[model samples]
Target: MYELHTDRLTLRGWRDSDLEPWAAMNADPEVRKHLGDLLTREQTDASVARFQAEFEQRGYGWWAVEVRATGEFIGFAGLDRVDDGMPFSGVEIGWRLARTAWGKGYATEAALAVLAYGFDTLELSEILAVTTSTNMRSQAVMRRIGMTRDPADDFEDPEAPEGPLRPNVLFRRACGARV
Candidate 1:
């Protein structure tokens, strides 16, 4: 099993036990604010299945993040393939946590570890991050992790509906860059 350890968290592969909390986090409006809408349990399960498949096939994907000290399943943080049609196609780093896990710097901490894994371990030359223009919270996390925004890279998310979510901002960080 691929696992990554940070100062306060562990990023590991998905488990059957993570389904309940994962569903609840997906259902939380606050948590879904930037992710479009709340996902049904079925949708959440399908997503978990997909994440597992990606891990099995590619050896890495969105990892199920947990607090090291408490073993609490806080949420997920890792890398995913940017869909084929996206403007800036490449691997993207992302995270999603329960509302309780917010504001504690867990996202930044876990993201730093994931970034290191992607660059240092996986040897990826670059990683990107995307969020809706209004998602200042995630943008803050992106900035905290040393990702920089390139205005020309920003594009409307084709997958998002014709609304606030469509206008997404892009952030990028190259391997070996200071963070």
Candidate 2:
């Protein structure tokens, strides 16, 4: 299984038991604000299945993030192929956690490790992260992880079926480079 360790987090592949908490996170309105409408439990399960399949086939995907000290499933953070009609296409680093997990620096910590894994283990040339224009928290995390914002590269998300949330900010980091 793919696993990444940081001072307070463990990033690994998904588990069946993670479904409930993960779903709850996805279902939280506040957490889903920038992400648009909250996802149903069924939608969350499908997403988990897709992540697992991607990990198996591509050898990389969003890893299940856990609080190492408490053994709690915080959420997921790692590398994934954007695979959509966005400006950044080849690969990206992304994350999502429960509402209670916010403002804890967990996203930044886990993201750094995952970005390292992407450039080191996966030998990626670069990784990008995209978030809605209003999601300053995630934008800050992207900057904290050494990614630079590229307004010229911004594009609408083709995957988001829900309308206006499509316009997003694009952040990119080159391999072996740190901000």
Indicate which candidate wins on lDDT.
Answer: 1
How far does residue 154 in candidate 1 sit from its true spot (Å)? 1.2
lDDT of each: 0.93, 0.88
| Lowest-sum lDDT 10-residue window in model 1 | 81-90
Residue-level lDDT tens digits of model 2 in 1-179: 67899999999888898999999998888888888878999999999999888899988898999999998998998787777556557788899988889999999999999888888998999898989888899999999989998688877788776566887888889997856
User: Model 1 compared with the native: what TM-score?
Assistant: 0.97
lDDT of 1 at 57: 90
**C-alpha RMSD by candidate, in order:** 0.8, 1.5
Name the best candidate (by TM-score). Answer: 1
Candidate 1: what lDDT?
A: 0.93
lDDT of 1 by residue, 75-134 (tens): 999899999888868899999999999999999999999999999888999999999999
